[model samples]
Target: MAVARLGTVVLDCPDPLALAAFYAEIIGGKAEETEEGWVELTGHEGTPLAFQKSPGYVPPRWPAEDGSQQFHLDLTVEDLDAAETRVLALGAKAVDAGDPVRTWRVYTDIAGHPFCLCAC
Candidate 1:
């Protein structure tokens, strides 16, 4: 038997509403600011994603410069080329860090958190 089940993954960001909005845009859901500086996204197919305000939130450096990335989201896309174009329009910045394979690409949200668009 399982002791406990997994819950929503919460991300710390300078602007909870903005970060949550970003994810909601890609994930197809509504981002709700339920409380002061706290936001939650739902109505998607899988686990929920939430955002919490960090007063002194310093965005992570992808190559781990000033601070290392603690975690990242891996999102599957049907068409990498199409998704890339759309995400970029939605304020996602592609990371130039060397990716040997063409199966996936790296990008950062407006808040500078790393995520991947995987074709697998």
Candidate 2:
């Protein structure tokens, strides 16, 4: 049996509202800020995604030999090329680890958190 029900997945970032807006664009949600300064992406299907304000935030490094990537979100999309283009336009920088053959491409958000757009 499960110990508890999952509530929401929260990410720590410098600007909660900004990060929320960025993910909202990609995942189809409305970025709503709370009185506590935390931002939540609402009205989307699946598990909820929220952002918390973290002062002096330092984003994790991806593809590091030391395994610096603490965590990452894998977003499945119908069109990988289109999604990559759109995310890049939204200030997502691509992380080229030099692996040519792969179904998923890595990218970092404006706040520098690593994420991937996997082909569905």
lDDT of each: 0.86, 0.89
lDDT of 1: 0.86
Worst 10 residues of 2 by lDDT: 96-105
Best by TM-score: 2
lDDT of 2 by residue, 52-94 (tens): 9999788888877877788899999998889989999999999
Off by over 4 Å in 2: 97-101
What candidate 1 gets wrong by more than 4 Å, as runs, is: 65-68, 97-101
Residues 1-120 of candidate 1 have per-residue lDDT tens digits of 999999989889899988887888887899898999889997887888999999998878886876667899999988888888888999999995245557888899999899999886
Cα deviation in Å at residue 78, candidate 2?
Answer: 0.4
| Residue-level error in angstroms, candidate 1, position 2 | 3.6
